[model samples]
Target: MNRAALRLSARVREVLEEAARRPDRGDISTTTVIIWVAAVTGAVLIAGTIALVIAKYNGQLNNL
Candidate 1:
């Protein structure tokens, strides 16, 4: 290839490599983490409705 093409390709490769080294997007985002934690917690609560003592203890067990 020509010198100009090689130079452009090298710069583009350098930028891509630098970007790949940083893992800060999509699944690792703050909102995604919060949503994942909330979903898991909700699932646990729903699955363990009978064993959720805190919920009953906080309220009067008679409510259930």
Candidate 2:
């Protein structure tokens, strides 16, 4: 049982060391930025449309 625990600990250390040595691939590209902007714009437009529709209905309800 002790030998097994030592082996597991050694394996975990090796995996962590390998992960630390790997290079980062974390930069965002221009196309990704454009897509994100478009998504945000679309979400804003949808929310505005819903708000306008609710306001129109609410005004009608108040009149009745």
Please estimate how well model 2 matches the true structure, expressed as its whole-model Cα lDDT.
0.91
Error in Å for residue 42 of model 1:
0.2
lDDT score at residue 6, model 2, on the 0-100 scale: 100
lDDT of 1: 0.83
lDDT of 2 by residue, 1-64 (tens): 9999999999999988877888464768889999999999999999999999988899687888
> lDDT of each prediction vs. the true structure?
0.83, 0.91
Off by over 4 Å in 1: 1-27, 50-64
| Candidate 1 lDDT score at position 33 | 89
Tens digit of per-residue lDDT, candidate 1, span 1-64: 6999999999999888977997553447788889999999999988798577666696776679
Q: Could you give me the TM-score of model 1 versus the true structure?
A: 0.38
TM-score of 2: 0.51
Model 2 regions more than 4 Å off: 1-25, 61-64
